[model samples]
Target: MFNFLKKKELHEDGTFDESGVDAGDFVDQKPLDEKESEIYTDLSIHPEWHLPEEEVYVYRFLNQELPPLQPNQVSVYGVEIKEKDGGLIVDAFVRNSLSKGIQMKPAAIIILDKQGETVARQPFDLSAVGTIPGKSSRPWTFLFPPSSIRDSEKEIPAQGWRLALELKKKPTKHSLDLSDHWKESLPQEEAQRLHQLVDSMKPPKAGEVNFFGLDARQADNGDLHVTLLIRNGSEQGLTLRQLPLRFEDRSEEVVAEGGFKLKSLTVNMNTSKPWTFIFPAESLKKTGFGFVEMEGLSSTEVMEI
Candidate 1:
């Protein structure tokens, strides 16, 4: 059994320093051409292996160089893995690299096919974690083989399997804390008045949703009220289904669950609506954030305030 564990620590300033054996060093920098695909048999177990369990090969590729940065500075990028159709999907993102003092979010995607079936996927998101530092560009890659696929007993086709990579760039803003710098930026009276208004705001009514922008405010009672704007494009009514809301602490243990409801106004088809929900403040304080998931949704978007 070849068990490998990799870990990286982030500094208080939100930068990540890479320290490892250069596991990705062996991968050729040349793009993956068709000839490379021919080197490995499709869906067949490699004959040289002696281990009882399947093998997963991690490969890293340097795709491109990023713009120059100030001396001795570092940024962090992160990779996330999700399972899809018995395969793994990967996403990557870059953080703290923006010159404007904000973070830039970039994504990279990869897919793998085994035995003619799409068996693995990878999506990378840089925003999920810290970024690497200096003038060097950080390029990363990993592989999930058949042995790692949960249910491999059933044979899948070879032609159906394939691998791919896609990259995209988008704008992202990091949330700012009023106590951290907002007070200094705004007059005391205006700041206090804004704080009072937020403190007095009520929870979203049932069936009413608000799309208040990013940045979440903490109430004195230790509750978090997140407002989201919901836009309806169709002529028919949309029912908001229930999903789980989970809260975890700094240690990543679940501290609270439930207590928030999705409230939205009845939108006539082709109209837009806003909604909001309030969860226990202790939950956010413990975990930093809470998550809401509903069925038939492609993604979850959270605005800080």
Candidate 2:
């Protein structure tokens, strides 16, 4: 009775198909082409591991370079620029090559507009990490807010601009001050806590001990517990005798600090060691402290057993 009112169905290719079903619909489609398979395979890899975007513009800058004055003393590994919070953040990784430590005091980044005129000269007070150890690299980040650069006489050209790092040279043979440079900036109690933490661990050597996957939070008892995933890059097993750590605020002020001994001293090579430090309730103020800024391995030796 109502069968005559049913609408006809059409296949994707646009022909009415009144049969129960067509042979094409039952048959399996052909396997994807070689090129199509490759596309699916490429999507599996993480995008972060891919190369930096390559877009053409007016300005050109080198990502990495060796300073002419003391090529043997230090080298800039790379520079990365990121936009955050309506500002530009510049991160520079610098390495020390000399056996002696190198200081980056009077450190500043000079931004130049077209025609090579200085647009803004922002100085960095890396008091937190005043000196970098020999054979090690550390990151220095500088932020440029939109309001900070809006007053510039010359705007950043579409062609791009230059970012030059100007640093003063200070060569000291392992005599650089390792104490909490954040002393003046942090609260008295916080500064004292940091000073105590750094005192326990010795300065870390590059390629010796590196930190990753750090986590920190307050415990039920009001103490601050910090955990770090540390990797031993050396060939021998490491028995940490002294490990010091510090937490700093955005202003480079120390907030919480502490360290602990490993129950099992010897950590195997190419293995990750989980270390936790606990700061007493009174170590930090009532308010929440900021992120981890500074940490180091004070004294350690190769374990034979």
Candidate 3:
């Protein structure tokens, strides 16, 4: 209590002060791990520009292997049109960045008939946005109305139309090399087997009615609980007996009150019929197939988790 003059000075921020320490003193810093470093490096490599008040990015094609289109190359992007109730709708943005000033050009929306003849060719407005030097402007919206096409007495033989963007100047050509992600992820043999199984399990005819949906969740004991909802869509009553339900990877039979024996039940048609079944959680983790077969009815397989 008498040596009060030997007290050290305290900083207001509660941090120790080393004013006398040299600025060149070595300090150890931990290096980032491999995964952490990769993530940081990737974010800095490709920077994306955010659109004003828009959520989606504007680009002709995404995740394709083609070389980046030059500032002058013209390309079209839209969904394929099929002959249905409503005629096809085209919503695409055109991109072209050439010399300075705003360029306006007349574009053609050509529709060809089945006999290789041009049925309709309508003119549309095309504008270019000139913000960055040598950067092409992207088209906002180009619509082709369905009423513009001619209706055939028998059937419309038209396949699809192309919005040809006639360019003033031919830019440098570039080749795009697109790689498929799905092919790389799955083995060729396994992928083919999955495709075959899917092709075989086509949905019933529109008139041949059936109603079904799946309810799946994990239990407290980590087992996957799956419930099948089957509703009768027909007029007559249907009988189900000895229904064999299977889990793809699971070989164990579900224990029932009747010692694993199959039971028959009469389900009235046009009713909200329900059937409950359970499978182990491990069955879903493996790559295999599951099915349910009843007499006088087609067997159905469970594909999705």
lDDT of residue 110 for candidate 1: 34
The digit string of per-residue lDDT tens for model 1 on 1-305 reads 11123211112332222211111121112222222211110111123434343232321221121222232222223233444565543332221221222222443323344433444334435333333331233323344544455456645332223333332222121121243344566687855654454344443333333333323445678776554334333334555555355434335575545744444324443333334457775555454444442212322333121
* Residue 236, model 1: Cα distance from true site in angstroms: 19
Off by over 4 Å in 1: 1-108, 112-117, 125-141, 145-160, 167-305
RMSD in Å for all candidates: 19.4, 26.6, 28.8
lDDT of 3: 0.34
TM-score of each: 0.22, 0.27, 0.26
C-alpha lDDT (0 to 100) for residue 160 of candidate 1: 28
In angstroms, give how far residue 47 of model 3 lies from its true place: 19
Which consecutive 10 residues in model 2 have the weakest lDDT in total? 37-46
Candidate 3, 1-305: lDDT as tens digits: 10122212222332211111111111121221222210100000012344442223213222121122322233332223333344434433333223322233445555444454554445565433222222233334444555655553335432333334322232221111112443576587855654443234444332233424334445666554444434343444556664545433235444221211336555454332334455455544443334443212333432211
Candidate 2 segments exceeding 4 Å error: 1-69, 72-78, 150-160, 166-305
- Return the TM-score for candidate 2, rounded to 2 decimals: 0.27
Best of the two (1, 2) by TM-score: 2
Q: Report the Cα lDDT for residue 82, model 3.
A: 35
Better of 1 and 2 by lDDT: 2
**Top candidate by lDDT:** 2
